[model samples]
Target: MNQTPQAAIYSPVAQIDALMPDIAAPVDAADFPQTILRFRNDRAAASVGLDSLSDEAWIAHFGRFEPLPGTLPRPLALRYHGHQFRHYNPDIGDGRGFLFAQMRDSDGRLMDLGTKGSGQTPYSRFGDGRLTLKGGVREILATEMLEALGVNTSKTLSIIETGEALERNDEPSPTRGAAMVRLSHSHIRIGSFQRAAFLEDRALLEKLTDYALTHLYGEVPGDNPPAQLLGRVVERTADLAASYMVAGFVHGVLNSDNINVTGESFDYGPWRFTPLWDANFTAAYFDHQGLYAFGRQAEAIHWDVAQLAVSLRALVEAAPLIEQLERFPALYAQAMARRFCWRLGVVPGDGADAMIAAAVRGMAMSGTGIDRFFHDWRGGVAREGHDYDDAAWDAFRGAIAGFAGVEDARRHDYWTDAAPCSMHIEEVEAIWSAIDTDDDWAPLHAKVAAIRRMGAAHSECIAAA
Candidate 1:
């Protein structure tokens, strides 16, 4: 790490190279025809003391993939194998993305500036490395909404529309292309461990284990680093799963590759917000079997943790890993209760976990939309709406009766609004339509503003509680 006399903010650390030097291959980014700045997250930039950079400088660093001052000499495309659908695939790695740089935030937390659709790498097989413009817009919307809902998610740092035409089966052909960068807690994934374990690389596994404990978890209470690391990762992953459930979010893809070591959500693709509670609902169109369905997210997370423990078996005894991993169910339940209460603007009481679970069932059975259900039940004060004849709704309401509301929660103007802010598929389409049809960003900007307002209200309620 290097610093100037003025308390330099960009304290670059090649944590990846330090931990697993042989894992990431240094690669050059794709040279696009044009670099047009589509979106700039100044707030995120401010955190890393980069908001002062001009647009050209921002483009030079993020779009053109120029290494930042005192950072890695070149971009590093990470390598790791992951189970795409519970089937181990050793050939996969960073096909279209790469680790651009690493620096510290204002709070002294290390953050990785990872790039997506940056260029083609060795891992990119039969694919042209590029991101669709619509994809970039969706990522921005997902991060913004998830952040507002209090989910642990990566922030979209910047989006640069590189002048290129890309063909994809997921969307329309010859769609616009762009490059995106996300500010994330960690680029290390559960797949990272799987890679080392699969290759019988104990040294790499041990280094990663210790690196996670030092960089991500800070300090563990136990002498056994592997066991303690698994425990903390389980806690955060459980909480992350609960946060998604409460937010009516379907991550669409919960593969081992996407499940990072820190448990913070990233690499948003085919994500969706539920209009109504339905366990079988899924976000990705190609997920025909619904393996990662909305209801099965927690199950998916638990399964991923188990795989992570298997990966951990290479470094330590399986008994400690399994023992620590057993704590996930309880932690998941606690997270569900706490997050549900936070959203409903109510304090947790007896039967909180069961009550929250019942509310999800009640929402489905009563035909109540997810956001509307929360908007109506905020502060434990039921508004005039919903079906009074529904038995499950009545039961849910009764179960939540003893909880008290946070003081002054209802005073926020956002609470009085006609509808709660949501990110349904149609709303997403409409926002993208504005951008695509007319190059109009007003709708997208306005939607973000509204989501932030909702977030502010929820923030105050959580703080007051």
Candidate 2:
């Protein structure tokens, strides 16, 4: 009888440590009884011994860890705090999660293999540490979709069901499980500094900042070390904003605790990609005030950056960091412009600015699904039937119908091509109205994938064009 593979297989932490000796600690799994689902990283699994295991065997190894031949493992939780929704919260950080150890990947990169939903830590503030299966699924999907869109993001390494049911407020009862794994970098955050600053631990703040600059932002070059580091981080944050804006993504929660100091998109929450171009669109169901609205995301990021700068003011020379912070709008504009160019399949040049602005204005008033409009525009352009600029200009014209003559022509070719971004502004509202009620994500997943594929192809064509 061909019995299924043995369930003794473990995570790749051992092999990863063996490959890179600089890894700070060893291999040990954090047992998260409430683990919702263990979503394994196929890429990472292949490098470790678990690659030979069967599905059932894989599930058996959910939170198991094998020590590397030459490494020592130390499992510990980090300390930090943040303000949730602009109100200062004196305590927060891995309340339900903990960093198991720092290890080196096969590529010689140092990464933290932490586990969320791994039971309560000292910081667990009135909440269960376990992650729900549905939540894990959402996070995996979000990370996958966002990364494919070319945004710098945190990855979902592994997700598994811990077989322990619990209660929760969001869903029906409590069917809690857990999630596990590692990430590229999980050091400090803007809130990390804030926590230290609040405690008057300037020394710790400086140490943390220095560690971050040397590790994460070391590649960035500038004349003044502090200013250069701040500037690089600002540039990355602005770039993130631009990516979020172009993709119509709303990160429901922008709490400082959720923001990564490494400048990568982290802490998945009630995120939603806008189907239409509504300036007021929000992702979280309870965010009635729209503190993190789709339109306000860029501004919110700037706010987060400013908070970080403020926290480190005493430790570093404030002038340079402030200066970098001042450049937020310009940096965001350039990134957004570049992204828009890619989406529209236009080459980088002068005058595209006016056309993009016009297109956005058209989208805002015309009530079209932002994703569909761009996809249709590119599809139309690729088919070689109508002038792309003309279609976009017509869509623009429909918004402000009084304009006429050469002004319209100039707008059409302001970027390139000859058609508008969309053919019909007439039926845009109808499209949005139809999808507004249905939150069943299966169809939306297929649609989002198609949209991303189209965007990628359009980007390639633009680069080549």
Name the top TM-score candidate: 1
Clashes of each: 0, 34
Q: For residue 12, what is the lDDT in candidate 2?
A: 34
Q: Per-residue lDDT tens digits of candidate 2, residues 1-465? A: 001112333333432222222212222345544333335656444433335656665554445433333333544556667778788888677766656545444444445556666666667779767776556656665665566555666656677767667788766555546566545455557777777788787776656665666655545333555466667768888988888877677888988777777678877767877767677888889888988998888888888888888887866677878888999999998888776655544455555556567778666656556765564454223224433345545654443232222211123222243422321223322332333345233543453344344334433452422
Model 2: residue 215 alpha-carbon error in angstroms: 1.2
Candidate 1 lDDT score at position 400: 81
Model 1 whole-model lDDT (C-alpha atoms): 0.86
lDDT of 2 at 20: 29
Per-residue lDDT for 233 in model 1? 89
The local lDDT score (0 to 100) that residue 408 gets in candidate 2 is: 19
Best by lDDT: 1
Candidate 1 per-residue lDDT over residues 1-465, each given as its tens digit: 001112336577777768646679888999999999999988777777778889999999989988888778888888898888788999988999999988887767778999999989999998788899999999999999998888888989999999999999878778889999999998999999899999999888888888888877777445788888898889999999999998999999999988988999999999999888899999999889998999999999889988889988877788999888889999998888888888888887778977887787788787889999899888988877644556867778788877898777677789888888989999999999898889999998898888888887787774322
Q: How far is 264's C-alpha from truth in model 2 (Å)?
A: 0.7
Error in Å for residue 90 of model 2: 1.4
The lDDT of each candidate is 0.86, 0.59
As a whole number from 0 to 100, the lDDT of residue 180 in candidate 2 is 60
